[model samples]
Target: MEEVFIAHGGCPHWGKMPTRDASYLREQYPHFGGFLAQRKAVDPDGILLYGHLREMLGL
Candidate 1:
């Protein structure tokens, strides 16, 4: 799973691409982070998980 995320170049934190790679992902897959904010907006859950993943991955 970790390798999959890294291979896809996604942040693995929010399951979204990083800011540096966001533009490219946007152009390639416009819906990349579209649901991120919406997901957060709907439910504030997983915030801690995201942070943990980010920290664990050293991203």
Candidate 2:
């Protein structure tokens, strides 16, 4: 289950169903900040961001 994965330091695939938030994912991914920066560059207006994705990216 999700708890078990979290207990073992499992990181969910960003493209799939991820229950963890950006704060938790930031710790798991080494280049999380860079990824965010890149995302911003690609979508400065966040036109593609909505719902869970917006919340997940903390935008």
Candidate 3:
């Protein structure tokens, strides 16, 4: 049987995932460019969570 996982807390609305907005970071804090780049590379798959119910109803 194949195994599945339900990972939580990485959603943008949850406010826990690292920011991918490079331009915003660059303008606000130039020193964090390297850190942000490293974070982006860590999650190559780029999976994001959204409300399925809300999306289905066009919320």
Clashes of each: 0, 0, 0
Write candidate 2's Cα lDDT for 1-59 as tens digits: 77888789776866776777889878888899999999999999989887888887777
Which lDDT tens digits does candidate 3 get at residues 1-59? 01121143232332333433444335545575575456458854534324552242122
Where model 1 places Cα greater than 4 Å from the true spot, the runs are 1-20, 42-59
Which pairs of residues collide in candidate 1?
none
Q: Tens-digit lDDT track for model 1 on 1-59?
A: 65676578744354553443444444555675765466557766755546544443333
Q: What's the true lDDT of residue 46 in model 1?
A: 55
lDDT values for all models: 0.50, 0.83, 0.39
Prediction 3 global C-alpha lDDT: 0.39
User: Which of candidates 1 and 2 reaches a greater TM-score?
Assistant: 2
lDDT of 1 at 57: 31
* Native-to-model Cα distance after best TM-score fit, residue 14 in candidate 3, in Å: 9.7
RMSD each, Å: 7.1, 1.5, 13.6
For model 1, what is the error of residue 44's alpha carbon versus the real structure, in angstroms, after optimal superposition? Answer: 3.2
Q: Report residue 42 deviation for candidate 1 (angstroms).
A: 4.1
- Identify the leading candidate in terms of lDDT: 2
Candidate 3: which pairs clash? Answer: none
